[model samples]
Target: MKQRLEADKMDSAQTVSAFVQTTRDKVSVINNKLQRLLDGYLDQLIDQETYKQEKNKLVSSKKSLEENLLTLERTQTGWIEPFSKWIDQAENLPAVAECGTLLEQKSAAKLLFGSNLQLSASEASGTAQSPWDFLQETKNSFKNSEIFADCAILEPKVGLEPTTCGLRYRCSTR
Candidate 1:
């Protein structure tokens, strides 16, 4: 599984690199087109109407490409680092939940289940499923498994003390 994850990460990195290069190339091409359009207008080779239309198109394309490049660069490893960190800290979740502060526990929950945290009376009722419901489902689905089966038992459901109910209330819906 680790090898597969590493391979997938490498594939994603390569894909992002290719996308960045493609966007750069497209921006360069559009820039060249804009320059040519300017030159044509300056030399009186193309009418003003034609120059305006082509220039507008080139500029729009260039702007879009540049924005895409910026987004790609910014997010290249944004998710990967967090995911890798989560994997690295997977074993520490129990410790974090057991000994860590309320804030740390919440932070770990957010990292594991994303930010769809909700605090309500129903969740504290214990009749309502915990946020780690998916882990339960996974464990149920793979009862004989050696990996996730253990993970299912790693952390007990966060207790519902009225004081800490507010803390346990912040759980991932999904």
Candidate 2:
């Protein structure tokens, strides 16, 4: 089950990377064309006014493209990859089956059923802290509830417990 979750996370990362790469490639092509256009204008092949207007457009487009590339890089490298790694390493807890609707326990139940689990936004900090610890902390935040769910065990940290005490709660709201 843990292996399957890891594989799913890997698949998501690949999909995100592929999309970012495609965007960057398209921007590169546009930037290249703009550079060539500016070069031709500067050589007096095009009139001064025409050259100025065209160059301005190209420069503006290049700036926006560069900004987009930076944003995508941050999203992919700075967030998704690290979060995926963390999720793969977080600890798992036992799931509790309650009478409430399944949607209430979707995330926790998914963990129990071996379905893919997505790390919550709280667990996605840019830091390199242990994922299992983060998940355990998150689970503890909701420990007052009645719904119980199972989580996977991430590799133990040095001098830490083999598995973290996450939760076993039942929620009344479905």
Worst 10 contiguous positions by lDDT, candidate 2: 165-174
- CA lDDT, candidate 2, residue 24: 78
TM-score of each: 0.60, 0.42
Best by lDDT: 1
Tens-place lDDT digits, model 2, residues 49-80: 88778778867877886787677666654554
Q: Give the distance in Å from residue 127's predicted Cα in candidate 1 to where it truly belongs.
A: 7.9
The residue-level lDDT of candidate 2 at 101 comes to 50
Q: Assess the local accuracy of residue 130 in candidate 1 as a C-alpha lDDT between 0 and 100.
A: 46
